[model samples]
Target: MQNQLIAFEGFDRVLNYGLDRLRCPSPVGVDRRIRLTQKVASIEHINATMFRVVLDSAIWIEDEDKPAIIASLIAQLHAAPDTT
Candidate 1:
């Protein structure tokens, strides 16, 4: 099995980049299984009102559904409210 992970700072950029990366279809000639996991977190700066966004993803290579799964996770995170 293989795993792939990613992190992003901006909400919009995270979504855009995640989707673009997921556009590639078919992990051909690969025998290993793949898994994907994504997470988003926000933190507030002590001196600033703006919140920082963190996007994380874990995936395994050769997983056929990894792209769609990761994309969905990213979308959900983007839709979530900013806690910070």
Candidate 2:
């Protein structure tokens, strides 16, 4: 199945902001960005073949932060138990 999708689960306030940012550049509080990056890496995928892309809202992450966050998420995805 090549059709893959990404999903996020977390506190409503945070998820709302994260989703919004993913859609477009939007303002987010520092605390929210910190929380998002911390949780982004822990995503467990139900399907193992698809690479999960969890991006932090563009408001806070700049320079090295973006790459670090992405790398962390990829690491977590690889470490996740294969469910498929």
Looking at model 1, the pairs that clash are: 2-60, 3-59, 4-59, 34-60, 35-60
Q: In candidate 1, what are the lDDT values of residues 1-84, reduced to their tens digit?
A: 112455443444322323323343444344666566666643433232333334444454653544423332323223234577
Q: Candidate 2's residue-wise lDDT over 1-84, tens digit each?
A: 101234433312222213322342343445453223333434444354323444432223343343222222232232334557
Query: Which stretches in model 2 have alpha-carbon errors above 4 Å?
Result: 1-42, 59-84
Best by lDDT: 1
TM-score of 2: 0.20
Instruction: Give the Cα lDDT of each candidate.
Output: 0.41, 0.33
On the 0 to 100 scale, the lDDT of residue 82 in model 2 is 50
Provide TM-scores for the models. Answer: 0.27, 0.20
Q: How many clashes (backbone atoms < 3 Å, residues ≥3 apart in a chain or on different chains) does model 1 have? A: 5
Best by TM-score: 1
